[model samples]
Target: MTCKALREGGAQVLAWDDNPDTRINAQSDGVALTDLDRADWSEVRALIVSPGVPLTHPEPHRLVRLAREKNVPVIGDIELFAQAMAALPAERRPSIVGITGTNGKSTTTALIGHILKKAGRDVRVGGNIGEAILGLSPPRAKTVFVIELSSYQLDLVQTLRCDIAIWLNLTPDHLDRHGDMAGYKAAKFRIFSNQTSEDAAIVGVDDDHSAGVMTRLKASQRQSVVAVSSGRSLGHGVYALGGKVFDALGRSPRAILDLKEAVSLPGAHNAQNIAAAYAACIRLGLLPEGIADAIRSFPGLAHRLELVGTHKGVRYVNDSKATNAEATAKALASYNHIYWIAGGRKKEGGIGALAPFFPRIEKAYLIGEAADEFAATLSGTVPNEVAGTLETALDLAARDAAAGARDTPVILLSPACASFDQFRDFEHRGDMFRTLVRARIGNA
Candidate 1:
């Protein structure tokens, strides 16, 4: 996408990949593949590397180090888009809503985009979620870009200034890339860089780390801060308490929407996402009533708590986006009788933190590399079995859920670990689950 954008921008694009197959594919796609060893460094304007390519922690990528040695500016796609947006005239500059967090970033980004688009705004949503930032429609008058930025992309971006920057609760993620929590937090804080007092900064106060971030931003008093939460109430900002959505961003408090009526936006985690999105749309000049209506009509994202199908008295939810314990916790908390399928590449700290929600699980079917370890963790705590694969796990879970006494038994695939163990990625895993569930329960 970056290559295509560069070509469209009228630059002679030169591309190379570490993998020979990727290089061949790039060449096949009309990208100019260059042998870096023989290329002239003086002729290269800037090195636009992918966010996955390391820049600092665990030592920078060899190409990154080489670029530094050549005194070339190294940046990611977001930086390129930012530069392009900056080049536009002031009146034609599009507003940006940058969302960053360990979890729920994709959902929040999609929701904001959906709301803005439904309200008839020219909106383009892409960053770490759907499309590369540069691949989206170019900057124009009355346009808004709701981008989901990961820490890696944030680490590489410098000049991008968001009109509405949301720091949704931070957790320990991408530790290898950032080295530690402090480093990770520092990388995420870059999303707020270059913002003025006229802009708005929405911060989630649900977790201690994010609360601390909110504290610092408040002390600065440079940008308007909307401290959002799903668990508790604040003097000002947006939040949901006891299934009620509150709007105190304007301090003219009002109960906008009851979360009970919001069938798609389930769980407290989503509530936090809602609070942040509501604050952003309101700041962007959308009416409170309209924002709430759009949120209700939101079809929701693909893999995050998505109810793919329902079989004989059982509901199947595909939450493959729950790549860690923190994410899986949301899925577990959302339902009552959960026949949960969990396990993949077990993340650090395992599922120990999810002990509180064990009682909600009717039974757990584990799969992939972390199956045995997860089963051991669930031993004497929650009734669980090592089912070994998603197909088997879903089969067992659906059968057991259908026979269960509960009014609405839920077969949930909220793997609280990485998906690289048994599938290509989370999307592939979720897609397989949806396919299998549909196959098992035909026509329904």
Candidate 2:
């Protein structure tokens, strides 16, 4: 999309990929393919690389090295979009709401866009969620671009200067791409880099890392910072407490909305997401009443605690997007008497940290490469079975859930690991789970 956009904008794009198939696809898309090794260095203006391409890591991509050696700026698609926005007339460029966090970024971005759309405003959502930012319709007046940016994209952005920027909870993720936690935190901090006092900076204060970010931004006095939290009551800013959203933006803290009736938003994690979205919308001049209405009707993101189906009294949920321990923990906290399905390409800590939540699980059906590790962690703590494949696991879990006397037995697919071991990605794994659940429940 970036290449095509650049070409459409009249910039001569020279595209290259290490993979032959990718190069072939780019060539087929009307891109002017160039051999990076042999191309004249002086002719190149800048190198636009994918977010997955490392600038500094296990090793920098050869293209990155070449670009640096030639003193050409190396950037991602987001930066290109920023440049395009800058070229447009001030009145023509759209207002941007840039959101980044280890978790809840996508949900918060979608919620903000949904609220704006419900309010009859022109809004486009992309970036690290569905479509690429460059692929979205060109910025227009009153069009608010609510984008979920990854740390990788954030690192490459130089002048995005979003009208409103949100930093949700920060957890250890993509540490391999960035050298360490400090490097990852620095990348996230870049979301607030170019903001002025006129812009709003909404920061989540639940995690120490994010709280530190809020503290630093407040001290800098570069922008008006609004602290958001799911756990505690903030002296100012917005907070979610006891299943209700409170707006303490100015004078006294007042309840804006009650989330007890919101079926899609189930857990405390989502409460944090809702709080951030509400705060951001309010900052952008949205009325609390309208924002609350939009949130109430939100269908919720697919594969993130998505309720797939119900059979008898048992519920099947596809939380396949929870490809880490922390995410799985959130899903677990929302339900009791769980028929949990977990395992895949394990992350660093495996499922060791989730030991506390094991008591809630009625039984665990493990699959994929990390099954043994997860089983060992659950040994003696929770009853578990190694059901090698997803199909087998689903069958066993479904049967067990049906036999259980629990009032609400949830068949949850919150694998605390990546899906690359037995599936293409988390989405593919999730889709498969959703399909299986539908078929089983439909047959039942």
Candidate 3:
């Protein structure tokens, strides 16, 4: 996508991929393929790399290091998009809203885009979500690009200053890619870079890392900070307390929306997402009542507490986006009498933090590499079994839930582990689960 877009934008594009198939595919698009290690430095404008390519910690990739020695700026597709926007006159440049964190970024990014598009704004949502940043339509007057940026993308972005930047809650993730929590935090905070006094910074204060970032941004006064929270009522900014969104950015706090009515926006985690989206839309001059109505109408993103189907007396939820303990915790907290199906490629700390929610699970069917380990964790505390695979896990869970006593048993696939072991990604895992559930439940 980056290569094709850059080509169409009239830049001389040279690209390479480690995968031969990918190289052949890009070559088919008229993109020139060259060995970066042997390419001439004089003719190269910049070294743009994918977010997966190592740019910093664990030592830079050879190509990245080589590019640095040759004085070529290394950047990602996002920086290119930024440069494209910058080329336009100030008034013509489209507004950009950047969102990042260990979780909730996708939901928040999509929610903001949905609200904008519903309000008739030309919104292009990409970056770490749907299409590549350059793959989206060119920026024009009133165009809003709602981007979900990963830490890796943020690391490669240098001059992409967002009109409004949102930093959601952060947790320990991609430790190998980032080195440690401190390094991870640094990458997440890069979303706030190059902002001026005119921009608005939306920071989620529910987590320590994000809260500390909010403090730093507050002290810097580089831009306006709209502190968001889901745990407690804030004296200022936006927050959700007692299941309602509160706008405390004024002299007195005012209730914005009753979250209970928003069927798709459930649980505290989603409340945080809603608060961030609400704060951002308001900053973009959206009316409060209109914003609330738009939020209520949001259909919610897939693979995050998505209700796939219902069977007999049971409901099936595919929360395959919960690829870590912190993320899974949110899903677990949102439901009860759960016939939980968990386990995949094991993550650090296991599912130990989820012990508090064990009582809510009627039974757990574990799968993939983490099955035995998770079974051991839940041995005496929670009724669990190593179902070995998602198919068996779902079959067993569904059978059990159908016979269970609960009025509405929920078979939840909120695996607190990465999906690389048994599937391509969280999306694939969720898709597989959705397909399996639909076969039995038939979309009821």
Candidate 4:
């Protein structure tokens, strides 16, 4: 999409990739046969690399080294889109709202986009949340672009200055791609690196790392920063105090809406997401009434905490997108008694960090490569068994939950690992779970 957008905007596009089966190759005007050994860069303006392209972390891709040697700038799709947006008329151009964090970025991005669309704004959501930003059609004059940016996307951005930049909360994630925690943070900070006084910066100051970043932003006297805290009352930001979303930027903090009233937005973490979205909408001139209505009507995204079906008194949740320990932790925290179906290709830390939440697991059915390690970790803490695959795990969890051993039993497929071990991606793994669940539990 980025290549297509660049081409449409009169920039000659030259796409190069080691993989010949890429969609971009079919759409591009010209394709270059690229490999680590190839060093031809005479005809290219800039090397527009994918965010998935490793630049500096886990050893930079050879192309990055080649670009550095040739003095040709290496940028990402977002950077190109930013430049394109600048070339268009100001009012005609789409307003961009960027959401970034370790967790809840997808939910936050989708929530904000849903609200704007409900309020009659043309909104297109893409970026790290699966949709390619450039592939999305140009929004109407009143359209708003809500993008969910990962640390990698933010790292490659040069001039992609968001009109409203939201920092949810930075946790230790993607360290392998960013070198270390500090390096990972540096990439996240890039979202606000180019913002000016005119732009709005919305941040969640609940976590210490994000709070530290907020402090630094304030010290620099950079831009208009709105801080949000779900933990306590923040003096100059939005907060969830006593189940109400409040804006604390004025002399007297004003109540936005009751947290319970926001139906689609649930959980303490979601409260933070709501607050940040509300703050950004308000800053962008959206009426409080419209924001409130949007929050009430928005249905949440799928495969996160999506309720698949209720069968035999057990509620099945498809949270296949919980591809990390932190994400699974949030899903686990949402439910009191969970028949957790977890395990896939293991990440660096394994499931060791989730030890604290073991008591909540009534019984964990493990699957894929990380099954043994996860079972070993939960040995004495929680009752667990290796189901070998997702199909077997689903059957075991459903049968166990149906036994009526515990009240309000919820069968949750919140794998705290990647899906590539047994499935193509998280969505495919989730679909398989849904298919198997529907086959077994739907009749019950």
Which residues of candidate 2, in runs, are more than 4 Å off?
A: none
Residues 1-444, model 4: lDDT tens digits: 675677677876655666667746554645433443554577667888888999997898988888888888888888877787778888888888999999889998988888877777788899887678888887668778899999998988888888899999987788889999999999998999778888888889988999998888888887888898886998788899898988787898888788788765667888888888888888878888889888887788788888888876788999999999988888887777899999999888888888888888899999999999899999988999999999899889877888857878999999999999899999999999888878876566
Q: Cα RMSDs of all predictions? A: 1.2, 1.0, 1.3, 2.3
Which candidate has the highest TM-score of all? 2
Error of 3 at 436 (Å): 0.4
**lDDT per residue as tens, model 1, 273-345:** 9999999999999999999999999998999999998767788999999999999998999999999999999
TM-score of 2: 0.98
lDDT of each: 0.91, 0.90, 0.91, 0.85
The residue-by-residue lDDT of candidate 3 on 152-270, one tens digit each, is: 99988889999999998889998888889988889888888889999999989998777889889999989999999998988889999998999998899999999897798788999
Candidate with the larger lDDT of 2 and 3: 3
lDDT tens per residue, model 2, 184-211: 9999888988889889999999988988
How much is 393 displaced in model 3, in angstroms?
A: 0.5
Poorest 10 consecutive residues by lDDT, candidate 4: 27-36
Q: Estimate candidate 3's alpha-carbon lDDT, on a 0 to 1 scale.
A: 0.91
